[model samples]
Structure formats: C-alpha cells, structure tokens
Target: MKKVKKIIWLIGLIYVFCAMVNGDAVISSITTEAETTPIEDSASYLPDKEGKENKITDPNNMGDSKKEHLDSEISSGHIISQETLNKIYEQNGEKVAYLTFDDGPAPGVTPEILDILNREEIKATFFPIGENVKKYSDITKRIYEEGHDIGNHTYCHIYKEIYSSPESLINSLKKSDEILQAVLGERYHFNVMRFPGGSFGDKLAPFRKAVNEAGYSYIDWNCITGDGEVISAPTDRLIETLKKTSQGKEKLVILMHDSATKATTAEALPDIIQYLKDEGYSFKPLSQIEEGY
Candidate 1:
C-alpha cells in the first residue's frame, strides 16, 4: 500500500510538470506572433526602437493652408479698403502689387500659369472673358478652386458691341457675371468688373457709375507687360517691360494676359515674380482690395 501511494504521488508530479511546460509554450507562441505580425492599420500607436510612437502629422489632412485664410470670417473674397491700403502704405511703405490676368482660361497658357502659381504658392486675380469661360469652363473652375479671385471681363469681348454705350457695357457685364455665376455655382459671387479696354475712356463714366452703384467696383492696371499691345513680345522683353513700368510705383496693379498667344508671359513669369520679390513687393489678389469696399 505504501508503494502504490508513492506511485500515485509520482504520477501527480509528472502531470503538473507537463501542464506547466505546455502553458509556457502556448504563451511563447502568442508573444512571437504578436511581435511578427505586421500592423497594417496604424503605425502611429505602435512602439518604436525608442519605445515611443510616431507623431501623426496633419491628422485632419486639410492640405490647403490658403483655405483657412480665404474662408476666414474677416475677409473672404474681397479686397481691403482703399483707405486701409493707403494707411498700410503710409505705415509700412512696403511696395504692394496686384497681379491681374485678363482674357484667360486659355488652353495651354492658363494651366501652365496655374501650375507655376501653385508651385510658388502665390495668388493672383483672373478676369476671364465670358466667351473663354464658356469654352474653358473647367479651367475657369480650376482658377477659382485653386484660391485665385475672378472678375467679369465681358462676354462678347467685341469692343464695338460691348463698348457701344453705358447700357451696352452694363449688359455685357451682366452677361459675363452670369457666366461666372453659372460656372462657379450659387455660393460664388464676384462684384468686380474690368472694362474691355479699361475703366478709362469717356464712354465708361456712366457705365462705371451704374456698376459702382450696383455694388461693383472697376479695376484698372497701372503697369502692364504690354503683352496685349505687343503680341509677339519676347520673354526677356516682357520681363524688361514689367521691370521698367513698375520701377517707381509704390502700389502697382499689373495687367498681364493669359491668352493662348501669350506664351511668352508664362515663360517670363518666373523671372517677373523674382523681380517683384527682389523689389520688395508683395503679390495680392484683387479680392483683398475689393473686399475693403
């Protein structure tokens, strides 16, 4: 009976030892699997060699920093007031320039300009012709989507038709404005107008009054690359013209065209931008000036 009892005790000891070994094996397998498994979902939470997780950059992934400034409550798609602008000039004396493009959304030239602008993170104003907007609506949409301001530059663009009289000019503006509204949808509103030639000329006085009274402002450029006047101007010539015309102006509204024929403008743009930078002038969209009113 003593031998039988010792045998039973030995069996119990063997059983306990086997169970302990199996339990350890199971735990080891689980730990190895956890270490080897690829964490596909989130790497940010997992421990690194330093035992610290990686920092998640841009959690919300709001890519555009411009959206914040444009969507701000203070100033959306409008310009700073002339008085405020003057005050800024008086205080800081920093040269400011508005880079205005007219007759744009052209096939090759417009997109190239947009790409350059995006790369540089600079903003400009586009005064798309109504006819061109209808033809290249997608590019027009791209212009606004990329945070540039748009103004009405008349639909027909025929000076004889659009510039016939005050009534004619107003009608042309409305037509152009409608096209912009249609393309941009209901939320987009542009209360700025640029005459077919300019806001000057005796023929535009009453038309200007009507537009101004109707809560629209007309803009005229003080400096130009003369791209419109000189169709085949070379890239260097365009840059030279820009530098020469904008030499002494403290506040300059530069008139540049983005028509298909104005490929030289796109070519000269980089140098022109650098010149502006070198001259201590900051680029601003027309909206900043328009909003102040």
Candidate 2:
C-alpha cells in the first residue's frame, strides 16, 4: 500500500513540473510577440509628406535616394573664380610653365591643337573671342569639356571696339562671358581676362579699374611663340622664340594662338612641350598662375 502511495506521489510531482515548464514557454512566446510589433507596414522606416507612412514604389532607388543626390553634387563642374590667380607649387625646385592659346576655337586649328595637347597629356588655357566662341560653340564646348580653362578675350577682338571706353570693354567682357557660359553650360564661371592685344597702355586704365571692380583678373603673357605678330609664322622661328623667352623665367606664361590661319603654332607645340620637359619645366594652364606677378 505504501509503495502504491509513493508511486502516485512521484507521478503527481512529474505532472506539476511539466505544467510549470509549459506555462513558462507560453508566457515567453506572448512576451516576444508583444515586444516585436511586426514590420508588415513600413511606417517604422519611412515617413511620408504628412508625417504618415506611404506605400513604397521601387524601394531600391528610394532607399538610396540621399546617396544619389550627394553623388550628383560631387560630379558637378568645379569652376575657379578669383581676382588673384592662386599659385600652384611643384616640389623640389621644379619650374612651371603655363601654355595659353588666344583667339581660338577656330574649326580646324582648335581641334588640331587639342589633339596635340591630348597627345602630350598637357592642359592649356584658351582666351576665345566671343564671336569666335559663338561661331564655334561646339569647339568651345570641347575645350571646356577637355578640362581646360577659358577666359574672356572680348566679344569682337577689335582693338577700337573693345578699347573704345570702359563701358565698351566691360560690355564686351560681359557678353563674351555669357557666350562661354551658354556653350560651357551653367556650371562654369570664368573670372579670368586677357586683353585683346595684351593688357597695357593708358587706354587700359579705366578698363582695368572696371575689371578689378567687377571681380576679375586680367593676365598678360611673359613669353610668346610669335604667332600673334605674324600669321603662320615659321615653325622654327616660333620654337626659337619660345626657347629664348622662356630661358631665364622659372614660371613662364607663354602666348600662342589657335586661330585658323596659325597652323604653324600647332606644328611647333610638340617641340615646345618636349623642350620644356627637357629643361625640367612642368606644363600647366593659366588658371594655376600665381598672383602679384
């Protein structure tokens, strides 16, 4: 009888223990479900315009929309604009040269010059007349797209017209700038200027003051390829002029032309580049010109 009683007690204890474990499991499941608050609706992640959740369409792009917006801002063109051209330095006492071509974007000449520059992996600044840029907008676009700097060289490239008065010069510059921005798109802003026949003489006083007041920097070349003086100057003479003028200058800004008639300038470019390289001079664009020179 005692053994029967002991067996009954043991069976009752086992049933009570099993019930307790099952109750604990049920309580745990209920607690987890209450805490989770299922994500079947996206209200937890994205908010709509009225501070409510909206149904998602194309989740991939929308999910990364912020990143895409930032990327577009990064890819926008970086236009340099300042009165004083900032200096760019080369380490270890290296010489720097800026190769600037003026009065260009002429159909055949500009393209050929671009090819030579591309072949040599060099960058140059082009001061295109407004009329020329309007005439050859496509080539002007190419110049900007190829990562070269463009400066205002006046609308007419006419000495009498541009140098007529301060107002005339300023108008010419403003018009030329408009043409370039139109061709190069809205992302670019040019504050660099180069006078038609070099920024000199008493005639330039008022124009210089106007340009300075308008937040622009005017540049004059220290060396020339002689292409400006004579149309289609001999290749040898052009090369010699470059070599002679650039001899003592550690930071040389060379003047050359890319007008349709000056094919010789294009021919002499490779030799000039090679000679500069041999003399341990680095080729740069006028945008890198140092101020107070």
Candidate 3:
C-alpha cells in the first residue's frame, strides 16, 4: 500500500512539473510547488514615488500611478468639464464619443471592421500592435487614408516583458514605431499611442514621461467593451457589458480589441455602433495634443 501511494504521488508530481514546463498554469492559482520555481517572467518591478522596485500590488487599480491631467496643448488649460459632455456636437463640438480599437489590424476581423466603418461614414481610432502593423500593411494605410485615426499599442502585448523595465517599454514602442514608420513612411504621424495594459501598469508615470518627451500623447481608456475579457461571451453579452459599464458616462471613451482572430470584438461592433447611434452617441477620432509631448 505504501509503495502504491508513493507511485501515485510521483505521477502527480510529474504532471505538475510538465504543466510548469509548458507554461500553462493560471497565474492566480499558483501553488507552493509553483512558487518553488518563480514564473519565468516576474511581475513588472516599477519604482513608485519613493523609488522602490517592489510595491504593493493593487489588483483593483487600473494601473494609473498618477491621476489623469489636462494636456498642456489646451493653452486655455481648461480641463473638459463633465457638463461639457452632456451636449453633443457634429462637425464641430458635438457630444464627445470616442470609439477606439486596440491591438488590431487582424487579417479578417480588421478588414471587415474597416469596411463597416467606411459604410457608416464615420472615422474611429485604431491602436495597432506591432506584429499586426507589419503583417497587415494595407489596413494601416486604409485606416489613415479613410480618415480614421491610427494609434500605437506597442510592438507586443506581453505585460511583464514590456513593463519589466522602463527601457523595455520604450524598446517595445520603438519596435512598433519602426514598423509603422517604415510602412507608412516618416510623415505618417502617429502621435497618439496606448500602453498595452493601459496607464494602470506600475510604470505608467515613468513610461508616459518617456513617450511624452518623444513627442506623443499617452491615451488611457476610461471605458472598455469587455470583448477582451472573455472569449465565450456572446455578442449580446458583449453589448450588454459595454452598455452597463457606460451607463452614466457622458463622453465615453470606449476601449475595444481588434487584433486577435478569436477575440470576437468585430462581431459585437455593428450592434454596438447601432445601439450607440440610436442612443444619440457620435463617434470621433482621438486628436493628438502637444501637452504631453
């Protein structure tokens, strides 16, 4: 009996060892055995106000180290009032509705979404991943030429890899920036970019400082569609998710994903657009400002 129990324990140990080697274990379910070998990529070690690499990890935090501030380019320095958004404007100061897509230019999904936007006669924001930027060159040009805004979403989406160091963050930007500039040429201004994990990452302040010094605006999202949250969420579920989250917001800056083939965000796009339009929302691109730059 003792020998049989030992064999069973050895097999269980082997199964777990294999799972670790495969890098397939869920981060939240990390066990003592898992901790024996620290995950290959540790969490981002960003220095806070006092310059400590390791700080309290606040899961509830979206990762913004600093509060959102007004961009300096608005020389009047008028921080947009919540009251201003209650009203809608068209071709001018219409109610502010920003429909921004991130991690995109996917092979099938983006092209379809682009077609939909073209038909709708409305321009939206696209924050592209580096690989997608390189692979789907035509979509990038189409996005710009068709009057939609193109923003950056870094070269890769690896949070730990990008946020491990300040240098890594910039390097990731450079990687995507190079691809974009190469394909679109130097004149294709992509002054707007989004951090992969949004500004909530521990490195937001320092990272924004670096990008701002390079002449760019760091856009952090105020709302998300939840399309990136779960794969099995049906389109209605996706739409409901957005509706619930955006219920009280006046100028909703909706975050969406368009990169992965499996994300199903495009499937939710038409309904989302229709519902928002029916609800009296107007869409616009994120115009770049010089304040952060």
Candidate 4:
C-alpha cells in the first residue's frame, strides 16, 4: 500500500511542473507579439504618392509646408511690402503728391483730365470701375498707355453688392481685374485696389485682411476734391476742398473722380496741380511710391 501511494504522489508532482512550464511559454509568446507588432496612430498617417498610408517624419513641419505651398500659389504681381505701405500712410516730411482718380474712364472727363496731366507732365493713378472699363475700353487703354498707374475699383461699384462680405469684395475686384485684363491685354497686371467709400472703421477689417492675403495693397485718400460728394461741384469748390483736406499733410494721396458727371474735377485739375507744385510737392504715381522705400 505504501509503494502505491508514493507512485501516485510522484505522478501528481510531475503534472504540476509541466503545467508551470506551459504557462510560462504562453506568457513569453504574448510578450514577443506585443514588442514586434506596431500600433497605428491615425493622426500621424498621410497619403503617399501611391495612395498608400505613410507616417509623417515630422508632424510639426506640416503646417509650415502647407503655408509655403499656399503662398507659392498666390499671385503677387506688384504687392508692396507692409513696411513700405506704412510709410505711405504716415507723413514722412517729404512733400509728395499722388493724384488718384476713381470711377473713371468717362468720355469727356477722363480725356480732359489726362490732357491736363499730360500738359503738366505729371503721372497719376486711375481706379477705373469694371463697368466703365467695358463701356470705355479705349479710354482705359489710353490711361494705361499714358503711363498712369491703373488700380482695380470693384466691378459694379455698388456698395451693397461689394460690402456684403469679404468674399463678395474679393470677387468683385477679381471680376474687375478680368475686365481690365481683357481691355489691357494679358501681360498687364495690377496689385493695387481702392475700396469704394474707402476701407475705414472696424467693419472693414476683414475685407482689408482678405485683400492683403490675396496679394493686393489698398490705399485710402488723405485728401479729397469732394467731386464724389457733390457731383458736378464747381471748380472753385473742388479746389477749396482740396486745400482744406490737404492741410498739414506732407505726403498727399489726393482723391478725385473723373466720372461723366464730374466735369468740374477736370476743370479743377490744372489749379490743383499748380497748387501742389507751388507747395513744393513732387508729383508721383501711386504705383511708384514703393520704389522710394
């Protein structure tokens, strides 16, 4: 009886030892699998050229790369640097006058204005609305050929349509550019714009940002002839308004209109130019202002 009990005890000990060895082997296999297999990070995966998923080497550089791509795609034909733009806005003690005509290329008025500018030997900037450019392509071409800087002034010049949103304003400017290009040829490009009613107040902040992002610069007038305020204003009143608005400004971006109704502006141009010249101001086109910087 004692011999049989010893045999049973030995067999039970052998079974327990085998079970322990199998459990250790199963744990080792699981650990090896965990170390060998890779866990995917969904955020780190990007599409490869072959349309397969690939891991980004450095996720931090992705934003910068994307920004660079976007910047390269943007057309910066004649975009002025922010520093140069700031100098234009601030008075720099140098007497410079930039005569800018908006809503123009009219039959009689634009020609008269151009003739006066030619006689004075001064080059000015003209912001012709797209509608007017279509109506008077010849005049627009003439203004460009005469060595005047041409800027985009929205398509329809309707405040409600343009001021509805920043996108609306950009679209209008682009549409006007298309019209201008059609008139001026494919080689002609302009990177300057003027907001109708001016880009002022907090309301236009988004529009200003959008314009800059689109690689365009905009200027607002520091002096005005009030031709837009009172269509067909008297020549003397226009001159007086110019004098009043131009007071104490060393750098003047003088605004006037050459729309069909603004014939008086044409009449006032000679006197306005004379006054600026007498004030020791050198006339410059708006496009050339960046060259000094």
Candidate 5:
C-alpha cells in the first residue's frame, strides 16, 4: 500500500511539471507573436479647435524636434482688427503689393513659381486648398520652408458645399486648418484667409461674420491677374489684366492662381515682378501687412 501511494505521488509530480512547461511555452508563443506582428497604419482621428473631430493622415510622421523647430520659426503676430483691415483695403498709404496665389501647391506649377519668387528674392502668400495640400504635401512643406505665408482656402474648395451656410463655411475652414497642421505641425496656424471667388457682396456677409468669429481675418483682392478667368489664359492676357486692374491702386492685393493648369502664370511671373518693381510698388507677404496692425 505504501509503494502504491509513492507511485501515485510520482505520477502527480510529473503531471504538474509537464503542465508548467506547457504553460510557459504557450506564453512564449504569445509574446513572440505580439512582437513580430506588424501594426497596421490607422488614421489618428483628432478633434480640431472647434471641438469637431477630423481624420488626419500624417504622411511624414513629423518628429518632435522638427515640430519644435517649426514652432520656433512661427511668429504669433497680432490679429488685424476689422478697422485696420478696412484701412489697408482702402489703399491708405504705402504703395505695397501683396502677391497672393490661390488653388495650389501644384506639382509642376508651384515649384516653378517658388523658383521664380526665390530668384526675385520676394516673399508671397499661398492659399492652398486642403485637398491639394494632402496630395502635394512636399510642395506645401517647401512653401513653408521657403519663407512664404500660407492661408487656408478650405478643405475641398467646393462652392456649393462650403457656401450652403455660415456653419458649413466655418466647418470647412476648421477642417482645412487641421489638414494644414497635419503637414506643417500643430504649432502652425493660418490667421488670415481668402474666400474662394472673393468674399464680396451681401451673399457672403453672414459667412464673413462667422469667419471673423471663428478667429480668422478674410482678405479680398483689389486686383487680379485674371489667370482663372479662362482655362489656361494666355500669358499676355494675364499681364494685361493685371496692369488694367492694378491701375490707380496704391495698395494692391493681387490675386493669382498656381494650379497645375495655370503654367502661364509661372511663365508670366518674372514680368509681373519686374512690372511691380518698375511701378514703385514693393512686394510684401500678406502676413507682413497683418503684423503691422
């Protein structure tokens, strides 16, 4: 009977040892799998300043050091008041030209434009549509790096969608700002914006108020290149339009497009810069004007 009890105890001990080894093996397999499995790239959905959530696709995976550097470069300039903006718009004093390009960061066009501006040693403002910013993030980054001011032109730039209501316009602006932050880092913010198709007339009155309330100062062009008036307008026509519209304007907010289709604008830019220089008008980024206020 004692021998039988001993045998049973030995059997129980072996069973317990085997169970312990099997448990360890299971845990080891699980840990290895966890380590080896690839994590899928998922959208980091985050809320914007307006408490609205937006899905930002971060292509660069910008590091903290780079972000800090960018933040350091950005200046927290004072927001221009309505009265000050009106004063600037009234063409009160200095003969300054604010060259603003809209609807871009185009693949071929924007880089070419940047090159021209670089050669001329002039800085301008670029109002890039959010969708374009995502598609051509590298160009967008280049614009910021090259010391140009950037403004939000809206996410999709669809007129009916954004113009349906004041709330709709505000939401679109917020979404565009989120997209800009995704590419340019969280510290970057555009205090100034230009409404698509110009923020003029009583139709946009509500939107104008909403935009100001949402912490943005909207700018309208007193002059245009008319590059967007026709599909791929001739370089001569663009130059002529600019000259005609800019006549008698001491302070010019010159509107132009830098979309891929508007290559002629790039071609005509050198002449435009020269013409402005000849006309005794100094080129300045829109931000510079705002900063004065």
Candidate 6:
C-alpha cells in the first residue's frame, strides 16, 4: 500500500513539472511577438521626402547614385563648396592626384583622351560642354561606361550667356541636364562643374547665392598646364608647365580646355599622362572634398 502511494506521488509531481515548463514557453513566445510587432510599425516612418522626391527609377540604377543632381551627387564629385580641406593620411600615405578636363568631349581630342585613359586603366574627370557633348554623345556614353566621372561644364559653354544672371546659371545647368538625359537616359546626370575661367571673375556674382542654394559646386583651377594660353605649345612645354604647377601640392586640379577647334592641347595630352603616371599619382573625379583655387 505504501509503494502504491509513493508511485502515485511521483506521477503527480511529473505532471506538475511538465505543465510548468509548457506555461513558461507560452509566456516567452508571447513576449517575443510583443517586442517584434512595434519594430515593424516604426519602420514605416523611416523614408523621408527626399527619398521619395528624388527616387530615380532604373532597375540597373535604382540605388546607384552615380550621376544624380548637384545636391545628390556632390559627395561623389569630390568637390567641397562648404568645407575648406580634407586630410587623409595613413602611416605611409601616398600622393593623390585629381585629373580634371574642362570644356571637352571635342571631336578628335576627347575620343583620344578616352582611348588613352581606357588603355592605361586610369579614370579622370571631364567637365564637358553641353553643345560639344551633343556632337559626341557616344564619347559621353563611353565616359560613363568606362567608369569615369562627367561633370556639367554648362550647356552653352558660353561664359557671357551662362553667367548673365542667377536664373541663367540654373537654366544653363537644367538645359545641360536635359540634353544629357536625352543622350544617356537618366544615368548621366552630372551636376559637378567647373566655372568658365574658374572663380577668377565674379561673372557668377549675380547667381552667387543661388548657385549655393541650388547646390552646384563651382570648381576653379589651382594648377594650370597653360595649354590654353600658348598657341601651338609643344608637348615638352605642356609637360613642363604641368610639372611646375603640380609641384608642392598633393591635391592638384589641372585646368585643360578641349572645346576650341584650334586647341593644340590634344598633341600634348599623351606625354602629360605618361609623366603624371611616372610620378605615382592616382586619378579621381572632382568630388566635394577637394582643395580650392
């Protein structure tokens, strides 16, 4: 009789323990579901208006912000309108060079420049003129295809027309944007730019406030190869000028023109590239964090 009582007690204890474990599991499951529900609800408010307004639509380029508008693309262009300087130094830092060409996508020269760059596996910035761009839309396409950065050099490339007023600068950029869109779909929307004659003249003065407001970064040259100044300049002269101007500066923004019909700049380009390569410089597009004029 005592053995039978003992067996009954053990069976009852086992049932009670099993019920307690099941009850604890139910509480844990309820707690987990309660915690996770609030997180899902909060995520609905995460995306802002800019995310909606500037949502570029291309499956291939859905999140690729390579050539968005000025405000969106400034960070990539490596230009700095607001900041003064950038200091990127490692334990053993190497030299950095930003190769920028202004007033380009010309007939023969721009193509040659592209070919040379493709051959050498070097990428540089081209601040191309809109009117000239219409002539060589293929080169513009190649520029994007080859992983080089293209910036708006203005639609007309006419200094007087573009800098006439604040609205004019904005309109010029818009026009260029429109044309580039036509040629390259929505992908080649390059808002990074170089002002005609750089910031030396305040012809952009009328639009000064608006330019910043519109989020356009105007680039001026710190280093000039003087290929634009000298007519029929030899390759050696151009190379020497580039070397002299690029000296003592880790960040060099070279100003070269490729718009004119009579530009001798093309002949000197290959030598300049070779010389710069020999000097252990890596090329980049004009971004928002560059040193100024």
Measured by TM-score, the strongest candidate is: 5
Model 6: what TM-score?
0.65
User: Superposing all C-alpha atoms, what RMSD in Å does each candidate have to the true structure?
Assistant: 8.8, 11.8, 24.4, 19.4, 12.3, 11.8
Each model's C-alpha lDDT? 0.79, 0.81, 0.71, 0.87, 0.87, 0.68
Predicted candidate 1, C-alpha RMSD: 8.8
Off by over 4 Å in 1: 1-92, 290-293
Q: Compute the lDDT of residue 227 as modeled in candidate 4.
A: 91
Tens-digit per-residue lDDT, 1-293, candidate 6:
99999999999999999999999999999999978854332122223466554332333333445234423632322335533422322113555666778777877778777777778777787888788778889888887778787777678867778777778878887788778777777644545666666655555565655766887766566677787776556667777899999887666678876665424577777777777778876666555233323
Residue lDDT tens for model 5, 1-293:
99999999999999999999999999999999989976446434446788777645342465787555554656433365555666676544678999999999898899999999999999999999999999999999999989899998998889999999999999999998898988988878767888999899998999999999999988888889999888798899899999999999898989999988999999999999899999999988876785544
| Location of the lowest summed lDDT over 10 successive residues in candidate 1 | 82-91
TM-scores, all models, native as reference: 0.70, 0.71, 0.64, 0.72, 0.73, 0.65
Candidate 1 lDDT over residue span 35-78, tens digit each: 99775442234345797766433323444673453346324345
The superposed Cα distance between candidate 4 and the true structure at residue 261, in angstroms, equals: 0.4
Query: What local lDDT score does residue 282 receive in model 3, on the 0 to 100 scale?
Result: 73
lDDT of 2 by residue, 245-270 (tens): 88777777788999989888888889
lDDT of 4 by residue, 1-293 (tens): 99999999999999999999999999999999989977545235566889787645334456887656544544324555545665795655678999999998899999999999999999999999999999999999999888898999999999999999999999999999999988887767878899999989999999999998887788888999889987689999999999999888888899999899998899889999999889899999987887666
Higher-ranked by lDDT: 2 or 5: 5
Residue 211 displacement in candidate 3 (angstroms): 2.4
Spell out the clash pairs found in candidate 3: 62-200, 63-200, 64-200, 72-291, 88-94, 88-95, 89-94, 89-95
Sort all candidates by lDDT, best to worst.
4, 5, 2, 1, 3, 6
Better of 2 and 3 by lDDT: 2
